[model samples]
Target: MAPKTTHPVLGARALNRATLDRQLLLRPASLGIPEAVEHLLGLQAQNTKPPYYALAARLEGFRPERLSALMESRAVARIVTMRSTVHTHTARDAVALRGLAQPGAIDRELALFVSRGGLDGVDLDRLAELARALVEERPRTPKELREELLPHWPAADPQSLSVAARCLLPLVQVTPRGLWERGGQVALTTTDRWFADSDGPAAGGPADLDETVLRYLGAFGPASVKDMQAWCGLTRLGPAFERLRPRLLAFQDERGTELFDLPDAPRPDEDTPAPPRLLPEFDNLLLSHADRTRVVPADLRGRTWSGNQAHRVFLLDGLLAGIWHLDEGKERTTLTLEPFARVTRADRAALTTEAERTLRLMTPAGVPHDIVFATR
Candidate 1:
């Protein structure tokens, strides 16, 4: 579809370049682990390794151990913030963003579980108090938390009690769970206890919704209200956009949907070179926006997932081009690429160089690595 003529429009490629620049994908950024986590809002961390791989993809001279150290020191943590999924966030954002999200996304998710009739006759306030006390004393795994809470409310669903605690409190996944190379099972604690020594926003204090909107533009802008909504899993944000309209720049997309961005935010040339990127499954670059055509091609929609699982994907020239799988052997590590379409020789070379760089940093040294492009 052609861009609408009524207003200055950003076509798909234009949007792609601008968003990639904001995402630190066009080039590796020179930023520390916590700073990068805050700037990108958070790293999708449904799995332990994605956050490390995500940092490797975006940061120059990134060592997995650096992030691991941060996790050990309470500098960053994994929590269920945006989209009600786990994200590795800076210490401060872990408090602020989770507080921001609690009223809407967290509560709504708990409601879904409540409506299932499992939480019948349960006093939500009592559940929150008991669960908070238990975790604050020490971090507890979801299973342990559920088992303890089940005895108190024998009639209530075991899982629902644990879910209620997560919703009612600003729970965070404690250390060793998110530490790279030293992984552990999921464990929960309130942000208040976890970041008690830290200085910044406190638990139960959410950042202003208006300020968050502006920050979202800075990171993933020229975006529609729906796009922002999709990223954070909050609704009725049109008012926040309206209040900031005077301070923002508005443009129409090809569909004539109004998009908002910071006036000074980078809107790179449409033809700017975008190197191939190997992103972890559920990377925010692919999941943040409602209209994903800017990053995902039309024909490749829904190709990233199978049933309920998401595959690790790679980009060629800034678009979703293929799936990648990694196999670790005692003697050698192999990375196989399965492209959605035939790749040109130049793109193939670039992909290999990128894969080797990732392997050197991620895999053990002296382990020979191979990058193979699978025949479709």
Candidate 2:
């Protein structure tokens, strides 16, 4: 019998550097907005601005308007793909990933609603067909959708009816809803209708889950099967990893967790310099892994969240160092940084510099900005 291949080991710092390189945070990459959006799989877009700020931190020459234009042009869209949460994805990924995730994450989410008795009497197939026609005819807000869907299932819970619509269909939050500086109320439409006029890939097809695994590794690799499963909110992915093993490089993390990454993917030196970054709330880098210790220090694990909400975070030396928020004013925008611990003058200066870059890229020109370190 052939001897089993022994995997090499990777320490935490080594893993952090490798993951950061793939994340495009080792340095700003010169990539266009649509390409970057597709490369990263998608940006965690629980809020309107996270995707733009996410691109600004990872890509060179990124402007919020660039992403906004993609939204307007239907080259990218906000949809529920991974983790049963909304993400801003490229037009192709928006279609493929959603279809791939539907069998697992999306179905499970709808089951949760059904289990709660909210969809007890509703025929799901009928609901999906009606909701698809309703939204595809013209986009509708959650309220409008729920109200329209409720009468058909008068016995069903109103909130659950709309949530069911979302879970049942590959709904896209239409333009103006996610546009920069031109935000509007959440509106819903079928991905088919939303991408109907675009030259990009059309909606509804079986996405190759194996191909998705490779893309997942390119963007979030040096990751374990569980990591990708956690990132995408799917399970039973071990077969995919096994199938790709011959083409992958395997290494064990300190905990003996086997990590599989693309053979040519960058694994930067452990001590490679990782500059500070200011990330928006719910950024994927912080959420897309089972072992976040690669980026989140152990002691500060739960500090980035309150109740169920995530705070915008800043990284010092490529680890979660602080939480930050902005106070926009007519004359000035104040960026308040709250570090978990005291920092050296050098670290503080570096954080300030990154904060300035973010403000310049995200805020309107000619708006004076202030960076304040709150007393921890």
Each model's number of backbone clashes?
A: 0, 0
Compared with the true structure, what per-residue lDDT tens digits does model 2 show for residues 71-171? 89899999999989999988888988898888788899899999999999899999999999999889999899889988888988999999999998999
Best by TM-score: 2
Q: Candidate 1 residues 170-280, lDDT tens each?
A: 888987787776788889999889888654444557878999999899889889999999999999999999999999989989999999999999999999999999999
**Candidate 1 minimal-lDDT segment of 10 residues:** 196-205
Q: What is the lDDT of candidate 2?
A: 0.91
What lDDT does the true structure give each of the candidates?
0.90, 0.91
- List residue ranges in candidate 2 displaced over 4 A: 1-5
